[model samples]
Target chain A: MITSISLPKVEKKNDPSLAKFIFRSIRDAWDYRWAIETFVTNNLCRRYRRSALGFYWGLLGPLMTMITLSVVFSMIFHIDIKSFTVYIFTGLLPWSLISDSAIEGSQCFVSAESYLKKLFIPKLFFPFVIVGTYTVNFLFSLTSLLLIGMVLGFQWKLSLLLLPAVIAVTATLILGMTILLGVATVYFRDLSHILGVTLPGFFYTIPIIYPAESIPEQFRQWFLLNPFYYVIDLYRQVIFKGQSPPIQDWAVSIALACCLLLAGLVVLKRNEQDMIYRM
Target chain B: MSAEIQIDDATVRFRIYRNPSPALKEMAINLFTRRSSGEVLEYYALKNLSLTIHGGERVGIIGLNGAGKTTLLKMIVGIYPAFRGHVHVGGRVTPLIEVGTGFDLEMSGRQNIYLNGTLLAHSRQEMMEREKQIIEFSGLGEHIDTPIKYYSSGMLGRLAFSIATMIEPEILLVDEIFSTGDALFVDKAAERMLSLFDRSQIVVLVSHNMNHIEEFCNRVIVLHHGEIVNDGPPAEMIDFYHTHIAGRGSNASTEDRSPMNTDFSVASPSTAVSVQEQSRFSMTSSLSE
Candidate 1:
């Protein structure tokens, strides 16, 4: 007689528990640091497995680029070589780091679609791996640049102590941009193609090959608007000019990097679950 | 006492995007055309469903293709979020969703063992200690030093299965994973899974193979249209599954009702009764089996 006809209704809450959930996810991501490192290492080593040189190929690209740049701008252009090699090398070092990181970051999630779909691991680590692997390549190029600088008789400046601070700021800026572009590239596949064309043009505008002073006085302030200008200028000040970067430049660069990083984190957190749908 | 694993009214929905006519003119016209401003179409992959899996319980999920069985397993593993409810898993969950998921094809198997083990939450030192055992279980011998790209699909599956089950996770989630390898490896893998079940508190397996479900799981749940149509002992649930398939005009004929034999050397005793039932339903083999 007591045949159950009705089932109990489950109550639904209007408010979503988004904040606590995101916080917990970030904490979980931070706890998986070892897995992130292994992923990066595996990706880097996987690219050149069939090559006889293995990882030595990491040095090939930057070395060739540095040699080509030094030859064209210094030799053909008849630019002064007194301290120009050191200056150009310094600028190229950070430029390659930012450019390679950006290029790799833009393609990061798109390339790892299989792994991303299959695993619940943190997505933020994908871009980190891109930047981290390129950082290793950048350091390899940096070592060669330092040797060239030394051979060309450039003296070590006391301001070189600020090198670590400069590197930290550059890394922070690159990290922020990488995260933004990486996530955006997932939705707009054309973003990578746009980056491919824009990077070379943008490189000339940055004072990598030429100093900011080379631009006319009327355009000096406009050149400062480029973030890479400040980045290249920081390296120039420490390695070439033998003086510390002004406090304002450091403050502004750090602020810009942190702002970009915060914005990227917000976008990533909001889109994390929906990312699979987009992919 | 520890809390048991509970799936509280979980639902999963998928949005299927349909492209407009492929003609350029049609695509351009559709781009300019607007109908409902905010309407979007979606398909329910898994409807609201609840199940309580207690400690020391082995439950098998069986369903036809696209029945949301894999979606349920992914939800339990935390890879997919439920649209409506929460999956409160009580302990560490190892999802054997796909073989070689995290393996680096360019990395040597020996190196990948450490990498894959770390992703499974094992420390470097822990992987180091278990390195020999993992290699031996994989049976790759000296070939373990070669990059995984050279491995056949079976070898890769064996290696992945070995590394995954090596860890003592509290819960194991397997999704048709045993059907990957050769007969010998399958037997070995099944034995490993059985041993793991003895130690783990909960095991949830999703497979369309009724024999596997009946052999490994005490309880089986049959899903249809993302809803649980049957939930009970494996024998009854499997019968319901076969009936549902037969009703759908499946080609499971009485002549096709071969005995459930893993090795095919001897017929399983249960298969004899199943074959007898199939003969009675042969006319409706297109209806009821």
Candidate 2:
């Protein structure tokens, strides 16, 4: 049965250049796009599988959070109830998208050990699924915000057309962060725990519960330190204030998105082959 | 395109860290200390292993646990990276490494087919087209609509095997697929497995059942301590395995030697007779040991 067949000797291949690595990673992700879709849909369904409210739970969770924050902050801070509700709604939705992506993304690769061990799935796939799932939920809650704002006589602005762009940019930023944190958590195992403790602390810095204008003048520079502030402010500008965000806001968020994505991809390319052994 | 696998002195090394995942504080503390952090132990799963498998070949891998049979399949599947050398596979590989490799148990059987298909690189549209055929082949009937968590192990195996063999893969790598379905389902699975072996350009099957290996495979490779100890026809390799490997202080008993022994009912009479002869040969060899 053993035939002495002489096949041509294959040459040793060089490691893929960083640019080629990134390109191949993108190609692999594209090839598995349907898998990502299935994962995202599967995640969404399982989230509310037994819940009576089903898909509405995605909307109600954030809506309830916004309402509770609006009432308490209005009473304590003496802010206008109507405008504050809209303000918190805009701020809270994007914040949850970011936080959910980070916290859950940290666990994405770990949670997917079974799949990763058995197949040759790209490392980017799980992070995309994480970002994709939260992004869908974010869009659901965003829709509810728009309908509720119209009901409350919040003026509809032409700037609302810009919501998708802002959401896309924000989702990209979340994707980058999720990938970085997810891969990091796979190695350190404690970074996920650290993220849980520190991420809520970041919420206060971003001015989600309070108005950005309320920050004292001297501490204003510090708001720029939190990357979420730029993104959340972009959402607030379009959804709550009915105006296009300043060029600096767009520039900052977009830059953060690119930087995080590049960092994530580089880290992923470096360790992807070895991650399974660690897991 | 012809399917071929060429592995040139490939080595797979795993680092067994003392603290596989150290906390941030421990890392920070270690950075300041004179002592190196946690000790690292490097283990080679596959060392300088080289083999070539061409199209139109059914290769069977046999070895003890931790002998790197699955590890080699994984390296060929591109799951485990070759640490030192290169592994070149000329075509797309479809691996049946385990039952339900990417299954979402919370999902219904129908949904799982789509999920598994996509994981195997099939598009949603492709899955939609093939979903009915897969369901029909599995014969789950109305139960396809219910969550797969309710599926018995046998039912899960049927669905997994059906989805995996939905299309003729260029290279089919099987690592002891656990298909413990009813006798009827097993018969169907056996037929499918034989057909898959026929259609796939290259099939690498890893199993302990020498009967299956002798009956199905033309060639066999024996692995020991991550190295190829022998490679030859199934008859020669099976005799080598029974006399030298399995018969010497190995825990494999006559019954333990053949996990697919039950499938003899469906096998050809001559094939079943050969299996009996193989078992008798193993028994005599073990007695001499």
Candidate 3:
């Protein structure tokens, strides 16, 4: 069948430059950008299509979880209501991006195998769609976090200008992990299952619920090594504590993201052609 | 406006795992413990097949069930990496293999037009501009707004056929997609396909229906076993295919064994480069992984 069959010109170029690959990958994904946006919107709509609140249901899930954890943990620790909500807000929203993308994006390649077999779509496309869908929700939650802080007389500092940079670093880190897991899951069926069990375990270890101060001094140094510590800590500082992130924090975040992304791209490039056979 | 292809002695092999999916945990433990989780079989779907397709050529591929018709298409599309040779396609190539394959059944047929369009490599604006024409041609009318799952299979096929034939891109490769819709719609589909043929620089069709191939193709290739057994004029090769290739299973008489003969032959393609003497597009590194 011949539906609008325009294709990107393919040539056997010997020893392609790294920049060429980057351009092609981005271009391939961009060419299918409409399809990606449609899927993302459909996913969001389908989740709450039958609900009375419609798209607002995206906000409710995180809001409800945030409320439940804030109430229970605040009561247990005798923490102030305002400060407790801020902690959960800073940590949980970003944590949801990582967790949701890891768990959902793991199945992305496996689930979209039919399309891969049919069209020469880039393997990176599905991960972008899954992460993009969740990132929209993450943005919504982030907006509410700022709104609440403003209502509570929280200061908006010049450091707030750095939020987009933080977001870029955060998206790069998760997008790398999500794409990596997406590829691995095509070969390993239980990857999403492993993710389902390990994410909660990973969460408790990250000090999302409790403050960094609650950690024993003996274990504090090791906690700093968690790449997410920098991300979550940066969130808290800028949002709750109203301080700019240190240059070292920015450096480590970007460097780690770049490392993971580089490795992820290599794995994707090697495995992409074989994915159709596996499926 | 042109597609130049040279597949220099390509061999495509598939490693079919015995297990539906080997448990990753067990595979990992086996790696550590030096044990095999399951048996795997590696076999060639296409072996040492070489061909050159030039611009403005219409080649039709006819073969039996396991004769690598689909694999050949995938090899050119670069989905199935060649194990031992190079597949150099110098032009944009559009594949119509497996029509409506990636359509989301729950989405409306109208929305799927955009999704399917982009998958076929058309941009959003292109789909938008042609939306009315596609709807009118598909004749789905109001049903286009309804979920595709609700549409009857004939209606679905019609929609797919309509979307597929909406535009003609360079180097179109079609596989047995023309014979599905209703009789009148099939006529319309055939008419549209003929128009695409006129516009496309080169077209490769793989269909079991010999009549379509006889009418549309200028050149025909009969694939038997894994290699091209014959390549020549459509009418003559098609006659050779029926008498020899297709006749082999039903009848029990030995026929001519020459490469140029109308019967199934043991001789290899004399035109192809020998495994020793490498062509320009020779595979240097093994793509075995």
Candidate 4:
């Protein structure tokens, strides 16, 4: 008979498997869910504390942006004021989630420097917090979009029930990109500035204000190759156009989201332990 | 039943780089050049350190600044991974390595307790349950609801200390925390720490103060240049670190060496110098023998 009398241990291994690394990091993200929720709550509370309107600001802020963009672009770009406003808000809100996550999420490790030096909080927790904050903001902007769309006589569709699916796909894609960019940002601090400069150019790549039909027939397929274009297109189909997205659009979005999510997790898993020293 | 620490030839190396962060221009150039550009200086913060502290032992780590005392503590707590060798720590570790972090300054002291507690792997319910204890121990009273930024540095220290010691951990890793807080609070903190010392299976204290180490620790380890120099009873180990490792440039024979430079400066000026010399002579003679 074998009798074992040993205690628990924390051992350092020269070689760590990426599968285990990712699994553990992901587990910690759930394990510390309270911290992430608390951070996001504190952040939103602080942001709205000074403003008199409080939670309405979450709604009216996007409405104001939509009104501003619709007026300027309607005349300049020769688009209809009503449909155009609805269209811009739909694309802009989702894109902001992506762009903001890419920009701020990159600094997840750098910004959390104060905390990282103190405890053993998982590296993924901050990235999740960043995602969580943006996700909440996205929901607010979405509510604002729906309210404004109804007032502007934009039609609602049976596909509206599927909005959660679109948001999930978009969020998964954004989260994956943000984690990858955030990890890379720790190694390359300059990536943050690069994101700032290129994000505007990336915005135009999606057909938010411009009509999708405007692209030349020869170049249309290549234009569709932009994976984010598919996500925005899906949003446009469901909310802006009041129709279900094409099955092909759903396939592209889900496939890209899955690929990006796996790659991001794999990258983070491989480099998570080594990151503490770099900071 | 108790925490055990085993570090076998553990080594940690840190790389210092000139312009370590890859600039946009450097990356753009490197894309075509096929070469790396940053100048890196690699050095070991810990070198082949083999140590085993059994359960129920209070170990004091005494060393001069830059002797890798903090690095060793971090390695044991699983912050910095060992570049070479193995480190196995049994049971939960609570590291007070660097305080005044893991908190949002804009958040109130009450909120910070939950934030920091969650960072220590405690659930929200656990923090909520301990909130009263943390507030009582911190002695912040009515000020607990105020933003942490409004609290004085000492008040923040109390809050940090209270949150860290809210529950008894199996292994408590402290780094010179006794230096903070006022006289009354330090005594209170010391009393709290001693109680923790009673409950913890292993307590590792890294302090520059010789008196605290001598009074509290059953065993002491002397560190010099990222390696363990000596390990034994607290009095002798502190004595070893104070004499041989403290004054690095001067030989033990140099009579003019300042005794005030080391922590063993409580004696009279003449006696301090002679005591240091005698301690130095005994260190060398013991090695020779």
Query: Candidate 3, what DockQ?
Result: 0.31
Q: Is candidate 3 or candidate 4 better by DockQ?
A: 3
- Report the TM-score for the A-chain of model 2: 0.90
Look at candidate 3 and tell me the lDDT of residue B189.
83
Docking class for candidate 4: acceptable
Q: In model 2, what is the error at residue B172, expressed in angstroms?
A: 0.5
As for DockQ, the candidate ahead, 2 or 4, is: 2
Query: Alpha carbon lDDT of residue B69, candidate 1?
Result: 75
lDDT by residue for model 1 (B1-289), tens:
4436798888775543332113344445656894222222355667888999988788999865556776788777766667677778888887776545667666789988888787766777888899999999989899999987788767877888788778786887877666547898878888988888777778888875678899999889888767888899999888887877534644445323332211111111223344324322321221222
Where does model 2 exceed 4 Å of error? A1-13, A71-78, B24-35, B250-289
DockQ of each: 0.22, 0.37, 0.31, 0.29
Q: Where is model 1 more than 4 Å wrong at Cα?
A: A1-26, A47-54, B1-3, B19-41, B244-248, B251-289
lDDT per residue as tens, model 2, B169-203: 88999877634578998788888888988999999
What is candidate 3's local distance difference test score?
0.75
Q: Model 4, A78-179: lDDT tens per residue?
A: 977788888777787788888998899889888775456446777778888888889888998898778877887777778789999998998889888888
lDDT of 1 at A129: 72
Alpha-carbon error at B66 in model 4, in Å?
Answer: 0.9
Candidate 1 chain B lowest-lDDT run of ten: B260-269
Clashes of 2: 0
Candidate 3, A156-250: lDDT as tens digits:
67777778878888888888888898888887889899899988898987878788899999999998888787877777777777788789888
Ranked by lDDT, top first: 2, 4, 3, 1
DockQ result, candidate 4: 0.29
